[model samples]
Target: MPTHTPPHTPTHTRPRTPPDAPPDAPPSAPTQAPWQAHAQPDHREFDATLDVPYRASPGARRTISIYLSYPDQGRRHRASWQLELRTRKGAVLRRWHGAVTLGARPFTLQRDWDGRAAGAAPLTASGTYRLRLQARTGNTVITQEWPIALGIPPRLAMPAFRPLATGATHHVATMTPIPTGTILPSYTVYYGNLHSQTNHSDGGGDLAHCTGAQDPQSAALGPPDAYAYAQAHGLDFLMTSEHNHMYDGSDGTNPNADPRQATALYRQGLQDAIDYNAAHAGFLAIYGQEWGVIANGGHLNVFNSPELLGWERNASGQLLADTETPRSDYASLYSLMRARGWLGQFNHPAPDQFKVGATPLAYTADGDEVMVLCEVMNSSAFSHSADESESHRSNYEAVCDQLLEAGYHLAFSSDQDNHCANWGASYSNRSAVLVPGDAPLDNTSLLAALRARRVFATMDKQAQILLTANGHLMGERFANCGPLALSVRYAGAPGRTAADLTIIEGVPGRNGAVSELAHTADITFTPAPGEHFYYARLTQDDGKLLWTAPVWISQQSPSLLCAATN
Candidate 1:
């Protein structure tokens, strides 16, 4: 590849300043910093509160939001919004009143208490409170309340978005300062999604007629159309991972269907993706299999495995797809992927899913290399929206965090999982890739990014967030000693500002809840020597969120390192 300055048009990345460059400009005065100064710990007083949530969650706030849309073809819908924080006995403590909009999906908003009563009131006490959403939609008004607690563990918070502190940042792509002593990568962010279902596997319904998920093998569009839709809608790539067992035309129960025919259908889907990408420059249309059933097993996306793996067969005992891997045996599936150098993603992970030896999320060493991504958030898989205003998305953040804590080196992805023909249009959320700045937006470069865990999950299509430790980027593992500086940088389209930024820390094998470590532009501190992982969460003023991939670090003293080498 030829080296060239990464132009800003493709990615909003700025190159690093040379060390000899002038001193940094002063930062603007802080605007009511959300965090209170903490008492720095003695270097030895570490890990004492690593598992304690209260030690980490004081004064924390969750980004709560709601989005309303009208898709009735030029018709108008309206909603006015306000909020009230009330005591358990129903006395209002804080009331955030009133922002109204009279349009469609543009009604995206976020609200949180300012830690006061009105203007200059003292801070609200730390206690459980009712977060009420007071809304007036068109001709009606309604109020909804959820239990919220200040200075409480995140999982117990009300129905607000607390992007799990589960993941890390990139350096080259962020154009942000490197934490003095670390080395990180310069990557360009590419936006797209990796999971969707088309007519190829009980999806790809026609927008004109389809309502939700279609009957297996009975939709109008296929993989190629999905690619076209995604590309035309401004995505850099889209992977349509079809359900493997659905190729037999009857959701794996029609024993009379020709297994060879089923295999050919799978191949045709693959060719469709190839042909689509060949015709469309810079847009990757990936075809792969979403293998497994959600009943007794969970689904995993095999992105590079060209040969379909399945257990369903027809009356002649002929195998569907190209092979007959035993169904629901994830351990065997993971081993095969390892041997074949294939990559996969855990889709909508469940506690009872992806088991080995009947243990869910059991740490499979072979799978540690094979599965690199997990779906942290997903829109309703069968949503029929095509205008990017889908509101019914499920938060798998806790589940994805569980995967990382379970000892899997997996990054996060926000999945569209579109059963509707809308492909990438059903939602604005995306799985972003930190593709090398010098590389083209193609399948190869994108796959390389995923293989390196250079990725992040974003709920907004236009926002960017990255985390880096020292000079190391998110999704990277490196050895370090001395001071540790973790930096998080963010940017969005014009007029958007970062409202909340948090650095979350966790130990890979601790299987404990993650903790909020810091709330600053960047963090600089000396931590006790050991293995740990850190990532960031950025909530934009518009209530959108971005979760970067986490960087894992193994720290040791120089003496220990030298001894180990000897």
Candidate 2:
């Protein structure tokens, strides 16, 4: 993704203060100093704060809270200030001019702003806008700026649902049938980008309004724009997991004093996603949020929930209560998500600057089973180099190994984790869902497939993998009786060939060991005893990678190691 810098040329100005006006306070000095001298005062400084709503519906009255504060020097001084609201392209949208007098006491002023131009033109397009404030006294001028996003929620007409194609020609021998009683019996692969962001949260880019030219400050696309981008770029599904707290304005200071207003803005984001999903057909849009706290637990992506769960904090930065779960306990968070039938996945579990906590490796079976998936590949910028040294383990892969070692049946997924506007086509990390050919491409089928763990993740957009053990699919569990037959099949991306394919066998309480599986497009194997789970990892000539979900092997009588279908 390229970075853009917004142009900062002021196109509108207003002189709110008269030059001859006396200071607001009585002068303590016998004579007035030159405006230049007043401006040059080392102690004379001001700060401006803008409180803009995270989002707004079209034609709604959006109020911006502006706060300006300056230190008191026991002397009265006169100054003029101007505020300008401009589009991302530097087009002036609104301007306000005013004058103020500094008294012996520190001066603090709060003002409400309605997004409108001088001619009553409403700034309604969805995109980023610049809010600039300038304060001048005695010829010296200082300015500060903030970014504001405005747009109407997306509400497109719904398209009719189309059933998946079904025919003998559409069937792939390697593809397994959906578990009995599932939505569809036969399945095909569907690809999508699962994680990304927009202006609704901390992500940059315009959602409702696009200036065509990318503004450096707001270059990321919003939910609706991102969905459109994904569909246009050949993706079958899209999910935006913006930071959960960004919409609530919970900064430990009750900054957004009106919680109702903050909640409204939060719901607006959900509504926009629902609207986009409703308007499109054959393309699925999943609504989710990245639940996180930098100091406590790392980030977790929650999908398919009916309501937005918020963690409210008090002044001391302690959790007060979550929107869904009244208690502030960490474990209860997962409990609440499960109670709402949401699927949670650990996102980017590496120890990065933004994430600090015990790795997913520390998760125990007590109640952590709700977290079913791990993000093995995140963002396009991740390093693709492989390390043969056992001690040099990557955080993501290490966590996946630990989960299997701990006896947790987890699935694998890869996402763009995109903050920019690229959406589905950024860097190629994607989740491929195996849905029945006649299954409806909607949220129910998608979520059901995910819950069933019928999926694979790939770093190459065009890569696909199919695995079956004794007629059971990836994410299924069966007993390892006699010889456990496993089949692996793969398809490479354009201009790329599979360089290596390895089968990894994992036993409870032991590290997973990789076996020298065949490098060909298809292979079969009968694992030795004590192998409780199996998965495959394929590396392409182009350095891309694909990982299938592990199939758990148990000693239960229902398990059967049948002959290979081929």
Candidate 3:
């Protein structure tokens, strides 16, 4: 047997061949293939293959080799190529947008991805994703995509930064309610809806789109139903943010179709929600709208506001609706929102729903009108994690982690975006804000807390955690030093002890890298250093915790560096 042992083929490496790929003509493909549409040519059939490395280590860098070969006049043209790597979530994890001149043959275009958002700052969590590619030569488009796994483990070594104080303040954080009211920042469930739907004259279908149809999740919860649901849930207040789309020219039967109709409906819906809240003693409805320029595929939101602004779209053809294509770009919409004197936030976004081409493009520019708070977690969207049902909830946390890593004013929310009216049966109202229900409810009290950005989103309604820092308290404060000073006190659902918490701080970068200041076991740092930001990662006696909004030296500082800025 030993003498007869023949040379065996090495099994470790094999010739990798790509599977069959659909043509670029599929309507749902990533994009227009970077080429203008053209009638099919009789002799032109397009096919391509790319060997992409898989199972990359977390925060690691790798390259892919794409073989481009096509039959032309019985001759084979070949070239090697590469493309950029982004977060499966479609964030520009790396911005190595590489392209090649198709006229050159057998030449490759290389893309180097550093696995960082905005092309810097190494990522923290690791996950799997797909690499989508599209190539075009005039009318000929080639599309290729492949699966990839990213596994970035936690780095044992922490970064260097000045530590901030981490402890609870004796006093509770309070906001002056509008129109003279007060609400405690303690309670279980808070409710709200995306108001653009019923408020408009045309009765827009869902918050996901402006089309008129029964909304999928929230439409079922009409006025009466919502009131009953709030009572059952022990909810003290409900918030509705409708689009200001009405122009005030038509009645309900023959609602106006003009853009003004949307604004008008928004105002009317606000009134209706307020009236209903007033009628119901325990329930209150706060007024606001998800206002944005519906141009250029961008979405921005103004949470608490009455009067809405509609901008005239210039020659560029932009609309600020939260649709796949806003008639206006980020700049126009941001400017309009800022000019109108409003506060806003970027909405829920995840990996599967929008891989860049499927929804309104994420804002990449800088501007003042960008909302100070980013909704890191929202029930409106699904997470890309293995758990599809709780993806909305899980993705919310994941988003918070990412934003914290990138140093953004990330806040958690559980909005219904309630277009259909059924209480987000599939998606959970997981992220929620706690408020005082002791006194008579008013929009001013609830909204004041929300606008101050002191809130947390949770998976379970029975769970609650409160945080504060150095006598100047906020929602949930993070204790990162000496005795890890901060409060992890909770209410409801007894039989729990020892609040499990993880605190993170955002640190600026030197070489364009985004990262957080390392967490410490004790809370001994001085509170006077007004540079770092802190937020709590609180869990119950049992391992259930919600990520609260960042409490920092200046809440508005991070907005300056936010990607949402136009």
Candidate 4:
């Protein structure tokens, strides 16, 4: 990590924007007129969410809430959805269904669950129960799942969080070491997938029939197999993130499973990845774990971890994972991640998930340091698109907007959560990682690029996008109270041209919406007296989209500014 000097801000009078404007040049007005929004997203998206306790006793009362937000008329889901409590055997124990309250502001649908089967029948099990919530939109299914502990002893209690938006100043001290060396340097864009699964746990099958979650460990392919597949498909690198719990041999349903076997399998996965990377000169094969579940919790891809993280144990109470970040305890996980210099991605997120401190998408200084990318889009999980024609995809850019606005810095990544072992082939989308020149196109540099947030999510593998502010590259944060200039650089394969491009600005910590500041590729504007972040977005004529990580800058009040000088 390296330190940087803050540029001087001329305060006598706000310097005119476009400082480079020729003295004899015509006057410059605001470009396309930047607009204002309070808490909406930079892109148009709709989302539905369900929140409930991660664990509840068999008969204890529990509360559940369903929320619908960000209305889009054209791609609207039926207001109606269903909620069901089911057994590991897939038998429904209890069920509920209804329409979400329709309004501009996101609203919640809540009810009490008494931990019993429908009609008061006693649920006679003390194991994990799956709570499934589902909704139908035009051609998509919006669903979420939460693992409810019926009788198991509590490990990570329902998380208690703090609102990160208001506590922005507390994290000011942690926003340093933006980049290790020169802020801007010659670089090359390397594209790859930071997520996907293999046979180590519920993935890895031939592309012909790898259409969905295969039985964990049932495939002839594993991490090395996936790496070979991705390399053949022209991916720069591929990480096979196995589900941690699946190491127990029961997809997280067998608590008494052997802890020794779980550790052995996890360690072996890491070794296999290391071996593959060593043998392959140009392609990187990474191994990590997809930690956590859906519903009350969200999945995070943990890379560079020494061992698998888990909460389950054998009947003898021995831990399964040698190194454990308590399951569902995201705060603890972030702290540990920072301590270990481990980087991760917020995988397939929704606004209502990943509630850190204040609310979902809220900030945590540790979270700010640990999470590098947020998956903005994911190709269809079970699609057998051996080619790049997979049109079914889910958009999570709104989640990215919410996280950035809430003060956690992250780059955008488009992933293919390959449950069917079809690595890099389900979609054309790729996470374009920008590595500083002179750095090797290996695991280390690729991970470094992610840590620096010098990355973008693109639906076109060959497209390139980067954002810079004040001559600083994307994923940069600094203190400024002067003319803030922004620029977008993009290129596409031989036949493609950018159809639309825009600069989007948002008030970090505003917990509000972002605005399209301009359509120009370059613009200079005076920033207001607060924290702000800006990003670049462009679309191709075919509707393929790409996004860059944002540049963040904060303005200090006079009192704080003077104290610093003294």
Q: Which candidate is the best by TM-score?
A: 1
Q: Which candidate number would show the highest lDDT if scored against the true structure? A: 4
Tens-place lDDT per residue, model 1, 149-197, is 4542222111111121211222234333343544444466778889988
Poorest lDDT segment (10 consecutive residues) of candidate 1: 43-52
Candidate 3 local lDDT, residue 422: 30
Cα lDDT listed for each candidate: 0.67, 0.55, 0.39, 0.69
What tens-digit string does per-residue lDDT give for candidate 4 at 1-566?
00000012111221112222212332453343111111111112345555566455345777776655433323323355799998745589889876533323334566778888999887766665667878654333456654455664223111121111111111221211212222445566677888888889877876666645677678778888899999889888898888876787665345467778888998898899889988987788889998876545678899889778987666566677888666567898899889989999998886566766546666889998899899888876655677887644666766678888888888899988887767999889998876655566776788788888888899898777767777788898988655667767666766666655668889877888888787667777777778889998776644577898999888555565545653
The residue-by-residue lDDT of candidate 3 on 139-206, one tens digit each, is 44444444355563222222121112111111233432211122233333353332223323222233
Higher lDDT: candidate 2 or 3? Answer: 2
Return the TM-score for each candidate structure: 0.70, 0.58, 0.51, 0.68
Against the hidden true structure, what lDDT does model 1 obtain? Answer: 0.67
Q: Is candidate 2 or candidate 4 better by TM-score?
A: 4
Candidates arranged by lDDT, highest first: 4, 1, 2, 3
Greater-lDDT candidate between 1 and 2:
1
Candidate 4 segments whose C-alpha is farther than 4 A from its true place: 1-184, 556-566
Cα deviation of 423 in candidate 2 (Å)?
1.0
For candidate 1, report its TM-score: 0.70
Task: Decide which is better by TM-score, 2 or 3.
Answer: 2
Which residue runs does candidate 1 get wrong by more than 4 Å? 1-186, 557-566
Can you give the lDDT of residue 305 in candidate 2?
62
Q: Model 2 — which ten-residue stretch has the worst lDDT?
A: 385-394
Q: What are the per-model C-alpha RMSD values against the true structure?
A: 18.5, 20.7, 15.4, 23.2
